[model samples]
Target chain A: MTQPRWLDQTEMAAWRAFLTTSHLLERRIEEQLKATAGLTHPQYEILVRLAAAPGRRLRMTELAEGVVASKSALTYQVGRLEEAGLVERTTCPDDDRGVLAVLTPAGAELLEKVAPGHLEIVREYLIDRLSREELRAMTSAMRKTEAALRSG
Target chain B: MTQPRWLDQTEMAAWRAFLTTSHLLERRIEEQLKATAGLTHPQYEILVRLAAAPGRRLRMTELAEGVVASKSALTYQVGRLEEAGLVERTTCPDDDRGVLAVLTPAGAELLEKVAPGHLEIVREYLIDRLSREELRAMTSAMRKTEAALRSG
Candidate 1:
């Protein structure tokens, strides 16, 4: 029943900025991906992770963790990808109950086709707007925040 | 069709950090809000916005813009809030076709009850982790990005 600590001016400014920036960035990314590739941001992340995996494949659970998505959500997206012939699910070699999401040639090709436009939106809206020093500071701060959230 | 400019190492690192931080932060906020108040983040945002507006009410379109939510999404969340007795929908006095979302006393009470816990998560996971200088950089960088996205 202690008094709650409120955010000071600087903290409030930073918090508001983070909220606004994140919302706008996600919306823009979603719009770009949907228009160009008919994929959601999470779906695009799935494909990118799979494309970079050792054999263009990853276990569903591992992919879910990497993408910060739930297992069920990942399964649903993988199903969509399968229907589109972009990805396939296979039995995991290491565990009977486990399944792997393998990026198909079509998925790879789509990613390759979609990546430049994706990066352009990202760079135009966010990365290119900040100075090197600002980028470094943001990276450092965000890394700290990410680590704390993961551990907590 | 010129070769798309790719991210250099620093840019890539910054971009990844932003993505991971945003995802984790959003997940944490969503989990905390749902657990504490049975509210999703967007629903909570709507309540907060209504609580701050003059007369504790705002036009639906204005609320949507303030929260960076789509009109349909805002309408859906407002509908849920109305059902929960936290908000009410009324015709805007100034405009016949416009609807206003007004926060009830119960809604304000719920926000008062919830704000402390929400701020705690934001502070613990994000604000307290950064130095003042880092926060300034983040705020400035994010502001620039927000402006660009809003204007573009």
Candidate 2:
């Protein structure tokens, strides 16, 4: 077999920084959400997505895709949210077998309360630390990365 | 409380791209590792870290930190690795209560075999897609983000 190509200095540096920052950012967000609102990161994402959707609801599959959660994982989180009266599942109007996740008023209120803290964490650790040009460059790079992964 | 500052368009774009790209990158890496090596991402991380450590061993707590896993989660992954004969646990020579995770020959061999395909995924999706300037910008931004999160 041919020899595998190894990462060069620049690639290695970028990859290591991305990996460390991603883990740290996720942990920081989870800590803030759990401490202030008693919600996990995935649960918080579900609420945010649902709150932004048209009519404040999304089909279950769409919600799963939006939150980058597997169907089973989404179901479990949705169940917990349902139990807490934060979200409710309803039969799709157009498709009997389809389900929709609808955010409740309680969920919206909680999101409004929790969102400021969430934004603070995001800004303090990520957005505010970078220059506008740096942010633009990183965003363009990640967008390309996302497109490639999706297509591949 | 005063109204919490919200993300502007530029910040929002960067945040969303980062979130989506991080998820996609992780999922792609996990899928590649699972298919080629029958290893989960965290398990692979453990082996890699162990292989790079002095004498191919690390204390459990140090291993956990290096891999960004919780102690219990690291314990569980290490248990599985040990069962597979790829890793072994031994008491620390200096500290009786301390446990060290040592990489077996099989573990290093597996990592060498799996690493090529893993690097391919990272390069194809992330590193190769960005320009040199973009890579530098992202690395700088992420390094700052990592520092802030680590301190905060």
Residue-wise C-alpha lDDT for candidate 1, range B1-152, written one tens digit per residue = 67899999999989989998899899999999999999999999898889889999999999998899999999888999999999999999889999999999999999999999999999999999899899999999999999999898
Model 1 segments beyond 4 Å from truth?
none
* Local accuracy of candidate 2 as per-residue lDDT tens digits, B82-108: 999999999999999999999999999
Candidate 1 global TM-score: 0.97
Q: Looking at model 1 chain B, report the run of 10 residues with the lowest lDDT sum.
A: B1-10
RMSD of each: 1.1, 1.3
The TM-score values for the models, in the order shown, are 0.97, 0.97
Which digits, one per residue and each the tens of the lDDT, describe model 2 over residues A1-152?
Answer: 76798999889889978987898899989999999999999999999999999999999999998888899999999999999999999999999999999999999999998999999989889999999999999999999998887787
Shift of residue B119 alpha carbon in model 2, Å: 0.4
lDDT, candidate 1, A1-152, per-residue tens: 87899999999989989998899999999999999999999999999999989999999988998899988898899999999999998998889998989999999999999999999999999999899999999999999998898888
**Clashes in predicted model 2:** 0
